[model samples]
Target: MTTAIAGRIEIVSDAICPWCWIGKAHLDGALELLAAEGLAFGLGWLPFQLNPDMPEGGVDRRAYRTEKFGSWERSQQMDAQVADAGRVAGVEFRHDRMARTPNTVEAHRLIRLAGVDGVQHATMDRVFRAYFNEGQDIGDRAVLGALGREAGMAAPTLEAFAAGDAARAEVVAESRALAQAGINGVPSVLLDRHLLFSGAMPAERMADGIRRAVAILRDRAA
Candidate 1:
């Protein structure tokens, strides 16, 4: 049997993190670019809650950002930066439609459970779009269930799973462990658990990292 490269790409991010969304787009583009170069690798999503302490009902986004960034003006600047990047990634970020800053624990939980059905990417993409584009509340069970359906998951099963606390603890624990590992930002890319760079990186940079990772795996296999 021919040996294949044995490494996976893990993207550590939160749904509400605009940069992560943009970074994911870049990652997708990078992966496609590498695929054209005859490199294909597995992709995984590692959960990270942007607001672990958010209220169950979430907080007013305007108030949250104004306070978190120390001023609304500064928050606008950050949003504008992301908006510019989003344009490059083809993601039209609807910050104006965003009302609440949700506790993304449930959203992460949805991704975790979605992984079991082998639609993790589709499910995660839907969640990101629902929040960042459609301005939908992803923290809600109904919304998550609907997204699961969109991702080809069985509706009743997804509903039951989302309505319960399955995978919630594991998601939180994994995110906590990731923080303990000294990574404090979203859009962090890892090749076989080896940290590459944090935040949204350029597509060429991601492709280079993937290419290098594949080379290392091939050497080890040989």
Candidate 2:
């Protein structure tokens, strides 16, 4: 029932990235389509903070964007562009509902714990949905606990994350290492530990990339 094309896929992304969401949809579609054609893969999500300097609680999105982009209109333009891409990717991005841009350290902490619970991907999806769809502030422990519940994580597991006593240093270290290695972008997928490509590629393009990667690996094996 499995295929020789099976391999590991690591996605370096952030939960708040609209393009990352779009990239995930494309990669997921590629995986499903390829699985039907005898390819398989194990997926892992890695952490990257867009606003590493954000406070533990977070700040107002409007103020943050205005400071970062130099103008409210420019920020609006970028959001509109992301929203247009979201439409094409089947993501109903509710940017209007988001008031604050969260620190995301807490959210990443939750994701790290979810991996131990064997619900990392589910938790990641729930986090993205909670933020981009439901406008939930994922930086809060209460919101994270609710997302953990929705993702089927155990009660104690969620509680442990809420206490902020778990996976904090590991997440911080890994994030720093990746940044030092020059991975400063989201939707960056690595196939078998080698950089495949970056950006929100179309599903067909991703499938082609996967096929090529498998072929290259096979050649190396021979």
Candidate 3:
């Protein structure tokens, strides 16, 4: 069966970004509204590492966040703020369960592979849930392989993909390119090469942006 797509949407984000997850949910809501209007899109998940210099295994979440945020109390407050926003987006954030902030390069590479397997959305969702809600270590190869398997990918294929560096350099390069392009944030969404708004915007606002982008794209084509 073939699906009729109006255009392609590329979302540049990191695997461990809570705001990116919330942005995805809002984007899903926007798509649902657009679907009712007979509009559809193909999604592309791009890589943007929030912590590209972190160690391979990663550091303790409390220690890392404390140092980054200036104190444990400040970090908790920030997490609470994000949690409150997440609740409005229908996302469950288990910040209390999150212990370690894992390096997400491997996870980003897997997302690239998932795109080829036609399960990128599901794989991204799985990674988000694993890190945010389930508090699982996304940097672990075994866990990533299991996530791929759950997303309908073959275990053997995932194992081989994990054992070597296939999309590693590509992911890093893409992330660097995005940074060089002056996009230093996650959840930077682009539709048909037209950059939409950034941040976890409301569904209605997102829909409006998409509508405007579609109109501009059609005008350009015309």
Candidate 4:
């Protein structure tokens, strides 16, 4: 009988990044496939804000992209690619419905809270679904509160947590740490704190990467 190997996979990303959504979908597919194949792995989500200093009320997506990337054409092209990738992964990403790109500090904080609650995966999925599928303003307290409730988080607790600066400092600190670690982009997947896989890779490739990482961990344990 083959012994199950445990591995840690951390994904550093922002909620507003289209590529990050695609990468997440790919990772989800890979994990599901691996599980069906009897492979074992643990996943974690880390904070990385694409727009760390975005305005409190957020900025129009078109204006933000044009200013940051210098061209609407470039942004549209990238979005098209991301949409295609998401579709391939069985996710319906409604890019047209996304109006604004807000500072993801609060969203990251919620992820931190979810981690403490041991429901990080569910919370992250709710955030992604709210932003990408339902066209909800993830930066708003009401939307986040609903998302938290959906993820089985207590409403009052999450409300107080969001109202305060809880985990805000930690989220920002983690983002800074990721940047200092040479990750200047979203959708960076780190395996075992050593191997780095960037961008939205195919599900099969990610599964292979996870398998190799698990093997290394097993060997190290032995």
Which candidate leads the pack in lDDT? 3
The global C-alpha lDDT for each of the candidates, from Candidate 1 onward, is 0.85, 0.87, 0.89, 0.81
CA RMSD (A), model 1: 2.2
Q: Which ranges in model 2 have alpha carbons more than 4 Å from their true place?
A: 1-5
Predicted structure 1, TM vs. truth: 0.93
Candidate 2 lDDT (Cα, 0 to 1): 0.87
Error of 4 at 128 (Å): 1.4
Ranking by lDDT: 3, 2, 1, 4
lDDT of 4 by residue, 46-108 (tens): 999877778988888889889878999998888887777788877788878989887788788
**Candidate 2 lDDT, tens digit per residue, 109-188?**
88889987788878888898889888899888898889988998998898888775698888888888888998988889
The TM-score leader among the candidates is: 3
- Cα deviation of 63 in candidate 1 (Å)? 0.7
| Model 3 pairs in collision | none
For every candidate in turn, the CA RMSD to the true structure comes to: 2.2, 1.4, 1.8, 2.1
- lDDT value, residue 200 of candidate 4: 84
Pairs of colliding residues, candidate 1: none
Candidate 4 at 2: error in angstroms? 7.8
